[model samples]
Target: DQQVKQNSPSLSVQEGRISILNCDYTNSMFDYFLWYKKYPAEGPTFLISISSIKDKNEDGRFTVFLNKSAKHLSLHIVPSQPGDSAVYFCAASHGGYQKVTFGTGTKLQVIP
Candidate 1:
């Protein structure tokens, strides 16, 4: 069984709008969650992260929220721009372990 899941395969948003990506996990042991954005022909780059202890974390236009009780998480991008178009992966890890599980990924298209 897949521990991490991204229900939506893709999302579209107009420029300067908001983009929301959702994720779910079956593993309750996960205490750390992260979001990664990947561009074509390049590796995924870390975007934002949240520990189980925190409900939300934000940086600039990017924000991540985690609901430990529900085993769900989401990534929000405000004022989405054309450059923000990419495949976003939701990842989770436990404690100090470096091993992480990643979701299938959601492709976001920011149309201008």
Candidate 2:
């Protein structure tokens, strides 16, 4: 079974709005959570991440929040722009980033 899951396969958001991507995990052993943005014909680039010890982490327009008790996490992008459109993947790993399990991915489209 997939340990990490992204229930929504895709999302659409208007430009200058907020885009929220959600992910869920079944394995509690995961201590670290990460989000990646992938463009067509390119590798996924690390966006933002949060440690299990922290509830939230923010960088510029991107913010990641972890709810360990609920085994849930979310990525929020404020003032979404067209360039922000990409497939976002949620990943989890334990024991210092040895092996990571990735979700199916959520495609985000920001309408201009």
Candidate 3:
């Protein structure tokens, strides 16, 4: 069973548009969260992360917002580019990264 879930399996956005990827979790104890982007054969690469203590975190064109009450989080990519197309995974863990749970993942396609 999966503790984290990404409702949408795929999303398509035009180049230079804003792309939003959403995720929800069943556990409330998860304090640390992370987002990863994966290409075809390679392992997932870290995108952004947020702690439960903070509602939001940002880096460059990437931003992650956490809503503890709703057990939901979202990753927003501004000016989405063709190179940004990949499968994104939402992950969470508690107790200082001892263990992590990942969502099924959402494939994002940025059309040029």
Candidate 3 local lDDT, 38-108, one digit each (tens):
99999999999999999999999999999999999999999899999999999999977477899999999
lDDT of each: 0.94, 0.96, 0.96
- TM-score of each model, in listed order: 0.97, 0.98, 0.98
Model 2 steric clash pairs? none
lDDT of 1: 0.94
Candidate 1's error at 21, in angstroms? 0.4
List, in order, the clash count of every candidate structure: 0, 0, 0
Over the stretch 10-102, how does candidate 2's per-residue lDDT look in tens digits?
999999999999999999999999999999899989999899999999999999999988999999999899999999999999977478799
- CA deviation > 4 Å runs, candidate 1: none
CA lDDT of 65 in candidate 3? 96
| TM-score of candidate 2 to 2 decimals | 0.98
Instruction: List candidate 2 stretches off by more than 4 Å.
Output: none
lDDT of 1 at 2: 90
In candidate 3 the C-alpha lDDT for residue 89 amounts to: 98
